[model samples]
Target: MGWLKDDVALITGGGAGLGLALVHRFIDEGASVVVLERDANRADSLKRKFGEKIETVVGDVTSYEDNVKAVETAVERFGRLDTFVANAGVFDFFKPLSEFEGPEISAAFDELLSINVKGGLLGARAALDALIKSKGSMIFTVSNAGFYTGGGGPLYTASKHGLVGVVRQLAHELGPKVRVNGVAPGGMRTSLSGLKATNTADESLETMEGFEELIIGITPLRMSPTPDQYCGPYVLLASRENAAPMTGVVINTDGGLGVRGIMNVCGGEDLSA
Candidate 1:
């Protein structure tokens, strides 16, 4: 549906998982994309896959300079930037507070928060002027952990919760010119991994055994969606015509995670005709 026809977007961490999915969705919806990825190989792969329809910038989201470069690339290549999607993130692999040593906790917290939270802040700031000029939108990728417990351990949960606040405050702060919103999607098998400081950098989310079953069993919808299934909200938020009334909103794409039953996780398990 060319919801974003002629629009231009910059997506951080757009080399894999949800980020890669967003890149595909945005382009399919008729938007030109610029991806900021830290991995050189991933950048090369994106270039090969999409050709001139997309631009790949080898950069990290946590660095202000890198964020600026990506934003600049979007503006320079596409003439304007209509959307800035801050989607780069890392996980903590459900390691609870008790599992962490005091020093390790400090180090891991700093690393994870810097990527999951600070990265968004920096990207928004870097794109602030361009977004205002075009009256564009900013879509942040949060998680079910943003609103409820059990989605992740303390570190991951806290980071997502922080994005919820960022969405609200930025929407308020950038009003009348730029729109700010977010998406809180449920479990998806992604390359999302834990912090190096936590010794779980090599552990991707998809490697978590029973993860698919866990999502299917817990949500009221009784299904685990993939990254592509989660791109609609981002597209809506990015669309100037369709989402004109949206701002300071965070769509919960977690298959009714908010309505989970206390006893069974899904109350409709015994539904009868």
Candidate 2:
């Protein structure tokens, strides 16, 4: 049997990208999953692809009611929730702070924070009762941006950092029953839609030159990770037997951003500078 056999998992944004990858991995490991995707089409797609093995919920993570309904649906369908993966998130597409005026920046900050930080927090809260009853775990999808400065612009970085705080705080408060943690992925290609900012995932290679340069130049491994590779850490965290003692842990699946090239003095310059 696989690590998560018979486990019931709730994965937000499971219709695509890292979320989709995690769904496939979890199911292959013999786990049942509920996909909470905002896009109705994506939810339908998951139903088609995974058949009855997966449950699809059309909801937004930012809404408390939606999160509530999602967790409830998971319990109703699977009888219990063994794990909750708060993987629904979007990038701010490096919309530099300088580009936005006072009002624009305020609007942008609110939008990003609402979707990224609030959504994860709501997911955790929604799953609290079920998780405590099952003694389950919560795993969030933080970005390399959560730890470092260059992964994204101001709003995104701030949101991720805030999420790290959420994971740690929840881990501290709900210990011994509900394990809380996060995974900080570096860069991967994915479809992240439904955001006010520019869509980073759908951008072309030529459009991502600056982004690629920023990532590859500093990563010690010098290779961007795939969305699928990042799912392993989540699976490990989700498995009670494997990561029982790990709480408040933030795994860096970010291609070694910790041990990498130097940062420039001129307001933190890039590789070529």
Candidate 3:
């Protein structure tokens, strides 16, 4: 039998990248998924590919009403809600704080925190009762950035760090009946493009050639995983039988990257040396 057989999963940002990977994995493992996406086109594409096995709702994660609708739809369609994954988020453009005006900083902070922080809280709140009834779990899509500095710029890092706190707090508040956990992914490829000028994976590599050098060299595994590889951590967290004692745990599936300190070398030379 599949690990998630008969479970109903609700995933935010489910139309692409890690979210899409989770939906596919969950369905393959026998769970039915309800996807919450802001992009209608992406939702439509998911529906066309997966048919009724997956349900797609196009809405912004930052909206409480949208979160409610997603939960309602999941329970109404699947008979019960078994898992909630708060995976909706955006990247900052790597602009330094000095470059940001007060209004710009406020706007960026609000935008990032609204979707990344408040959105997760909203999803959990909306689905809390159902999860309690089903003894289900809450999972967040944090990043290695949550624990370290290099995964993103300050804004992205702060947002992820805030999410880590959310996981911990929720786990404490909803314990014994409902579990809460997070998955922190490291370097991986995904299309979080065009919204701004934050370094792309390739661009970062070129701008700081051997940018991945320090990370790979320090990691015991010496490799960066694809986005799909991160899905297993979520699946495990969502599985009651597998992760029964794992409440409040933040699984850093970052290929050991988080353990290594951030690279501060200039011109490919270790400054400390």
Clash number by candidate, in order: 0, 0, 0
lDDT of each: 0.93, 0.84, 0.82
Task: Point to the candidate with the largest lDDT.
Answer: 1
Query: Candidate 3 residues 88-142, lDDT tens each?
Result: 8887645567777666677677777788899999989999999999999999999
**Candidate 2: regions farther than 4 A off:** 197-214, 263-273
Q: Which ten residues in a row have the lowest lDDT in candidate 3?
A: 193-202
Clashing pairs in 2: none
Estimate, for each residue in 88-162, the C-alpha lDDT of model 1 and write its tens digit: 999999899999987999999999999999999999999999999999999999999999998899999999999
lDDT of 3: 0.82
Q: Which model, 1 or 2, shows the larger TM-score?
A: 1
